[model samples]
Target: MCLQIRDIKSKVIYCSAVLLAVMLGLGTRAYGDQLPHFVSVHFGDAIWAGMIYLAFRVLLTRHPLWLSLVLSLCFSFGIEFSQLYQADWIIHVRSTTAGGLVLGQGFLWIDLVRYTAGILFCYVIDQILQY
Candidate 1:
């Protein structure tokens, strides 16, 4: 029963993360520079969502730890690359500091490390919580 509940929660987390990713993509374009603050908020929210997804994989399921980290890292990096869409509004948003820092200017190898670090952080937190 516990495993079943955990599986359901994991599915919900994954779906929510996907929906949030889509919304964030559209929102960054929609708000543009007119709402830089939300850009920061959404970026942070993305990071937290990524971390939560990692935690769900590591703590709530029987998945391999390294695989979970890799998957999360790839997901983040994929989203970063996906920002290259030629939407004028997206370009304008990318011009803002918030966008540049969050969405990134282009591909940076460090982002993979950042995702790994986030996953590791979530893994550690989950382990500590379990203790």
Candidate 2:
């Protein structure tokens, strides 16, 4: 039916946006290390949070904005907190490029603030788009 097709199209668009955010986040982090210390440190974490928000949107297409934001914050903070564990296997995984990006190398309280900012930014963007 036409309605089904429209729904599918909307989902595709949402997924694509998520993918783009993830790619941009990764790209920024990949090059960010070369920038000044402050920009390199904070920008990646904020972008990572935005990527997390988009990921939640992709997974929970019909969920309310607040729920998505909360879920994203929880997921981002969970990953950040998980860095405290340095088991052999996890350490080995973190040594690799993909694993390092996902797990991170160390814990930092500032990253939490960056994540909150990123999630809030995404929420605002979503709200604007709804108008």
Give the best candidate by lDDT. Answer: 2
lDDT of 1: 0.60
* Cα-based TM-score, every candidate: 0.43, 0.86
lDDT score, residue 110, model 2? 86
Candidate 2 global lDDT: 0.83
lDDT of each: 0.60, 0.83
Tens-digit lDDT string for candidate 2 (38-131): 7776777787788788777767666677898999999999999998998899999999989988888989998899999988998899888867
Candidate 2 worst ten-residue window by lDDT: 4-13
